[model samples]
Target chain A: MHDTTDQHLFERVLQDNDQLADENRHHFDDMGAYVVNFMSAPGAGKTTLILELAKRLKDKLSVSVIEGDMVGDLDAERLRTAGVSAFQISTGRSCHLDAAMIARLLHATPHPEGQMIIIENVGNLVCPAEFPLGEHLRIVLLSVTEGDDKPIKYPVIFHNCDAVVLTKTDLIDHVDFNFETVEKTVKALNPKVELFKVSTKNGDGLDEFLAWLEARHSITLTASAV
Target chain B: MHEAAVALAILKRAVAAAEASAQKEEKAYAETAENTAPIFDVVKIVVQVGEFRNIDAESLEFTFSALRKEFPRTQNTELELINIKAIALCSLQNHQFHPEPANYFSCTICGGGIQNLISGKELDIVNIEIEQCLTETAA
Candidate 1:
């Protein structure tokens, strides 16, 4: 008799990844470090934003960066040049970096005192939104050149991100970037999201953006102290 | 575009999981006389995604179909998509509602529609159908 028994695995496929992500979160928690997952589209200024954040928060806190990319450590090298401890995870075939990759990366590196994990996820708003990667906070970048309708079209990233940074604002007037429409659209997607309009080129609005990190770092530090 | 990334993940995980299953089955059948390890044929894959997940199931399928050719384990596999609509709960009013995604919706009872997102964030592989190699010997 021919037999046919189909396997029913109601298992959540992303569950394994999420479990690994939770483990990563636990590692950071024990270290009293806050993990920030930075996500965005290509050329949206995420690397530049991260570099700026590193420079501003240099003396105040020790920052460790984990860079995820299709194949290149250019961003990691840039961060290293700036005196930041940067690690790169190259995903040859994978488009996005999963929690297991992070687990392996951190295992090979030593944990420094009072260090924060700044993870620059593979630059794609869609896939990165699904993987948590054990981040305490999620920041998505939006460059002025990219259309204002991105928030509505790619609502998942906007909705899930803890904050939105409108990058390259200095070039706002040069491009057809409508500031009001994007802000309204972002708020429509995530009502309570904290938004910052910044430009790393001319150094406009960097202080406020850096202050936001300062506030978050202090809050985490306070909680860990208690 | 995002589907390209997702499709790669789906095929990779499916292969990885099937390999583990094959190993386990081989070890369990070691005591039997016909101790041939099962070679799996992945016939179908079911992916469950939320409306708010911002993934196009059609696009994912296209991408998966294109990329499946590279994987020997899943070249002829079929894809099934389960779409989940986004839902919100008005805990203050004890009411739940399904709001249109990307819209600023308020709870009907409390006037605060964006109270909380209860569902529609799921992006998971819910099921996989693999035909196991079970050649029965004559008893």
Candidate 2:
């Protein structure tokens, strides 16, 4: 029996301290809060959706946002104007926002009472999906302009996401985006994932989306009450 | 994309281990001239990486090369990446582990569902096979 040294090496590697982000996740859980990690490709309307969700839910629920980008605080600035507490996390040259980054952002922006924090991860489908920010929900947004085959091309992101929010439905008529194909593919990848088709411009289907969110919040509250 | 960060973490750990091993060997060599041998020779480092980990092997290789240049002792070490296939273990029913590579794995018992990241999510230094250098006196 060639005592395979590989297994010993693997165990040693696993023992390495690679979880600097786990602490932040513990803090988030302690707050009895829900964090939504929003991911998508560049210009997929993540910021716009955050703005809309903030405005609609701010009065009803305590809402804050941790906006991530390669540089600049533009998204955080925009979120601030929308009347939601916003904190910007510029990744410098990093492509994705990891749990460590979110943990730092949390220190900069303390958890607010009765509010759920939304982490708008840097717009990249691949890298963002790899790191978990201890979010209760992972929402991957796809706009009509990005095409329908996106789910197929990036199945990992779709598969890991708790829900898929299809943005820019207002331009569905302008583009040849097929809802059927997108829905079918997403379902095939993840049957239990909640799907929402929304148009921020026209406010179409937003109410239903909000209702779904309210139900989720209510469930959280009930669980916490016990 | 984020492989650089992962690579950095792995490199730091490897360096620490190498340094510790090297120091122990150096102490033993000082005690006896016959025990004097080059701590280890350059060979290969095998690492198991999970598919879901999203580690770019090429990028990691590049980063390692650059980092190794800074640490003269670790130069010329080859990084052999082994991708581990992920198996989804559903938290729903009795924490059952599923070996199937599917889009998602659900637990039938608790309904607690999570993407089973089975194998590919690894960043480890599997083994370093170093050639034991013979002392000048022995030769």
Provide per-model DockQ scores.
Answer: 0.35, 0.25
For model 2 chain B, give the 10-residue run with minimal summed lDDT: B98-107
Which candidate tops lDDT?
A: 1
Model 1, position B69, has a per-residue lDDT of 91
Clashes of 1: 3
TM-score of only chain B in every candidate structure: 0.79, 0.64
**Model 1: runs farther than 4 Å from truth?**
A6-9, A109-114, B1-45, B63-77, B89-113, B125-139
lDDT of 1 at B16: 75
List fnat per candidate, in order: 0.32, 0.28
True-structure RMSD, every candidate: 4.0, 5.8
RMSD of 1: 4.0
- Worst-scoring 10-residue span by lDDT in model 1 chain B: B100-109
Model 2 lDDT per residue over B1-139, tens place? 7766666665655555555555656766767846554354334566777665556778878887777656544577667788777555553443644332233234445444443544445656677644433333322
Q: Best candidate, DockQ-wise?
A: 1
